[model samples]
Target: MDSFDGFVTGLREQLDGPLPGTSAQLTMAPSYRMTPEQARVEGKSCREAGVLALLFPDGSRVHVVLTVRRDELPDHPGQIAFPGGQREAGESLRATALREAHEEVGLQRDRVQVLGALTPLYIPPSNFCVHPFVGVTAAPPALCPTDAEVAHILRVPLDHLLRPEARRREPWTLHGSTVDVPFFAVDDHTVWGATAMMLAELLAVVRPLYPSLTIPS
Candidate 1:
């Protein structure tokens, strides 16, 4: 897969530069997208967090890790998400991302090569302003899930994300209101909300490099 390697190189270069940002994030956003004005309104009241899109080589392809949270969690219960949580005092966003990944899935910080950061997303339901980072390792890390937080772990191939069919929309009920939600369907998981939105930006950045890989607008 020479083309895939080229795509990864291109993605690394793009991440080093300016990101696609909000325009890209909006592509996979829920019906009611949160605005910067709203985030500012919440201001110091909003929680700050970081998530890692930890990628690794699997056989002949590259894959990223995602987790399904336990239902007992107070926030975003039983939802698909990247490994992350609220930032600890005195920790940088990058450190927070790596630390959370280590705790949630046993992905050690030393194994990850921090690529770059993605656009910050604001989640209205949880009142969290999340900063997402992209990282890669040579091979898949030994994933040991923290039972209290993670219900299951998924290793989604990058190629799957680039497929046009991976993106789908369905009606879902949230907070007593039914809304048409777009998501990335991987295996048996329906990834939506902030996690999907963040992934949209990543795909947008890499899609152009491989014209054959159709990514939903």
Candidate 2:
């Protein structure tokens, strides 16, 4: 098999075993002040959500899809995020992620192969406990973005993310205070917050498989 296929195999193998978990998530977290245990205490009654890190082969490399939320949206407006939403009744987290991806990006459920799940993260701002899953498609998806929810679809090559340079910090105002925010600079988009944290975990899992890729500690 090719390198992309091999990477998929490695990812599936990694998922089947133990995950890097909260330690990985902390690498890209906004603030290290609050630990996962602390967050759990605060998120006792948080709503549940699921997101997909959908990967597919594009030419010779693998790519992951992320969406830019429409500016008019009520939550996280104009922010880059995974295609997902709150869990629905009588559905598994995997199902919820796939359904939301289909609704937001027209990525059919059948086209995706669910690899496995990462650690669930609590978003204190939105009061959401988000469960992220890694999925793969053999071919690139023909995307159809929902104008109401998605402003643009970003298909970022995995190689780009593996590069240490892609991860950077910038000053941003939050809660009336200016703070440095860490983000992945991908395709003219600043992928920060929960999305960045999730990506960090995924990379922590797969980066070791490719010895050539250098990620900062």
Candidate 3:
């Protein structure tokens, strides 16, 4: 079987098992649900979209690619995030994801096979309802970040994410409201906010099958 199939099989098996009791997992699968109107009123009106690259080298080890947004951007500047943007006119979400991926990180469609999508997320600060789609590339990518939008390209080892210690939470005061934001510390770099939320959900879905998958401590 192809590596992608094997990975998905393993992922499914892991998710079917017991759910981890990590903070990341708990926050992603919240205790309460938000209504559509409530979600919209809570700065979720911004309709921005994006993609997540579930890149597997030689279709084996599943790694995730994130970009550091340029400091000049008004929102989410200098943050480690998935390479994605708003959907342009007459474009499909998949197409938009692929196009934005290429523009931001020089990822060619030929290298990636569109797998499917995860649930959409609403980011409050940016007012964007970000849609994260998962795609797998056969080979390791030659990433080139856009100078103006992307400051750096991060190819985070999947194993690192699977390690519980690499991910954590910290206190943050946003618009005078205090809360704990999820953060992933891979080496010296930190990943938080919506990007971390997506990662948490990704882990939720993929963790059931991979028994050895690590949960953040």
Candidate 4:
């Protein structure tokens, strides 16, 4: 937890108070290892492309807003995930993340100070390529979730994420196969997969600014 304490202080000092720019943008490409033949055969079965936003609030606190998908959704049903969805016609990946954030949660584009984007990440089970965007919000947001698609909204603190103890690798067994999932145990919830990957990148950026920062095991 000492490492996490250092991380929190560093994040607050670096990003807290007034920021220099109104917004920034980054293009991220996150890769995954999947069976190529299976990918070709699946041809994007349940495959999708989406985006997620990282919002920094007051103090050294950074909040990652995730959603509980409506049980009715055919894929990724009821899972806790970053706010995003499949790309729409004529939409760039950035547009998709922003648009989805607005539709899924009541986050307006105007309120978000988009810092940049991260690499794209692929999910094999769903065959998705997700684009992640990072933003620093000036104020805490009041979320209004669309009841049909979102059941609950989760806010995870960045400080907690940097704690090494909060980090672990969990093994998942599915379809007679096993995979190691990087995870962060926060409160009563677990953050993993693309979400965890994005967090890792975020920590990499913020941790260096403050050397005391450490990502949980």
TM per candidate? 0.90, 0.93, 0.78, 0.72
Tens digit of per-residue lDDT, candidate 4, span 1-217: 2333454455555544443211111111112333333223234445456667556564666567878777789876766777888898888878788888888887877877665655455566666766677665666788878647898888877666667777766677745677666566877666665566555666655654544565432
For model 1, residues 1-217, the per-residue Cα lDDT tens digits are 4644565687799898888888777777777774545323245467899999988878877788999988889877878999998899999989999999988988879988888888887777777889999988877788978647898899998889989899998888988999889999988778998899898888877666656665566
Ranking by lDDT: 2, 1, 3, 4
The TM-score of candidate 4 is 0.72
* CA lDDT of every candidate: 0.83, 0.85, 0.67, 0.62
Which candidate would rank higher by TM-score, 1 or 3? 1
Better of 3 and 4 by TM-score: 3
The sequence of per-residue lDDT tens digits that candidate 3 reaches over residues 1-217 is 2366787656545445553323343453222222334223244447768676555654346678889888889876788888888889888888888888998888887777766665566655566777777777656788898648799988877766777777676777766776666578976677876677677767666654356665643
Give the number of the best model, judged by lDDT: 2
Q: Candidate 2: which stretches are off by over 4 Å?
A: 32-34, 38-43
Candidate 3 global TM-score? 0.78
Model 1 earns a TM-score of 0.90
Model 1, runs deviating above 4 Å: 1-8, 34-45, 72-74
**Candidate 3 wrong stretches, greater than 4 Å:** 1-5, 8-45, 58-60, 214-217
Clashing pairs in 2: none
